[model samples]
Target: MSTGKGPVGIITGALSGIGAATALEFARLGASLILADIETQSGDEMITKAAELGGTATVAECDVTDYAAVERLVARTTADLGRLDFLVANAGIAEQSRIASGDPARWARVVQTNLLGTMHCVRAALPVMRRQGEGHVLIVGSTSGREPYVGEPSYLASKYGVVGFAYALRMECAEYGVRATVVEPGTVDTPLTRRPPAVRALLEQMHPLAPEDVARALVFTYQQPPHVVISELVIRPLDEAVNADMPDAEPR
Candidate 1:
């Protein structure tokens, strides 16, 4: 920890995209952070940047898809920081193919990273939070979770699971002073979204939400009074019409 004076937090997938943005945002708040991800170089870069922003941070090389790895990351955070105040289950992957032609292997990776990965992080953190009698868990879901679309079948399934998982986790942990929030962002301009050529083409026409936009929402949700929980937050770009068409469908 860089000795910053704020609650300690662990952000999964903290090296890039929305996760990176969220880490930077929290750093601006002087929060202590465990930037968890599989990318070491990016993590180091983020740590240096975080220090520049007046935040204390360290990188934890973690593969969120592995339950044991996630458990260890949670344990390590509390040991090094002395307390665990918040966790952002933000690690995820996306596939652009439809169910009929999509590779099952890719779909499996998507579910493991997006859905089970969230579950592992939350489950490991809950006990720690309950012991302290306070904590917050923020799961980054996609707008795809709430609506149907032509493509991205696996991604949709995973995110939908995330939404339900967050709600159920909220109910289970609220009494213990732990909070769970699901953040669903519509179209965001991130590497994941830009990877698909079709989505990249659409990005040229509309001003999609930036990664920082969703990061701000996460910070806002996390900074709320402990007693108040913003259960769900859905954000989309103004030009991203609701229930539009395949790919741009529903700001997902």
Candidate 2:
């Protein structure tokens, strides 16, 4: 759990965007990486990138929402790396729904992946962190956790849950020398964003932050001294303001 113990760091959704970038950044810092994702092609690329960076990288195709698979991921990481130092629960999804004609399926999928999947990762990874007596948990959340968006009901709900869970877990792990923190990013440019042009622009107008911006915050929080605990952060894009223009832009 202490710094420079094992080169092992576990990261999910590590094939693209912030997850991939964070993995490479950690490798650059001399940390061996274990990157997991559902996409084999992307995972392979990440593994290759880490290798090029002179850091060991292991890629596993894992769906965090799957309990058994996640369990295997933890077991494999421990088996291969000898010990686990950091657990980054970064896998998530986004979806929209309305009260009148709500897409139950989308809501369920988003909630399960973004919210329930996070719980699964934390639940499975806690035992190792507890045993190590020192570890860090970084969960990728969103500003929607605190500020609501009318169309993104499910995504907001899931992030809100994540923020709450991260704070609560931080308190629980303080005694064990393990820390939990949530990174609340706003309007990141990623595959998770699927909306009309106007809608996307409206969201940007509301508030926006890139995935790397959030990743920078994540690394900043994790790199802090052990005594310091950054419980929560809200990273917003400078381009996006709290603008309420373009009334006919889209219906929330």
Name the candidate that leads on TM-score. 1
What TM-score does candidate 2 get on C-alpha atoms?
0.89
Give the alpha carbon lDDT tens digit for every residue of 25-130 in model 2.
Answer: 7776667777888776876777777778666787888898899999999988888677777888998876555646778888888888888889888888889989
Q: Write the per-residue lDDT of candidate 1 for residues 1-252, one digit (tens) a residue.
A: 444568899999999999999999999999999999877787778989988987888998999888899999988888888889999999999887766667899999999999999999998988999999999999999899998677888898999999999889989999999988999999999998898777888888899999999999999999899899999999999888788655632233
Name the lDDT value of residue 112 in candidate 1. Answer: 93
lDDT of each: 0.89, 0.77
How far off is residue 197 in model 1, in Å?
1.1
Point out the worst 10-residue segment of candidate 1 by lDDT. 243-252
My TM-score estimates for the predictions, one after another, are 0.95, 0.89
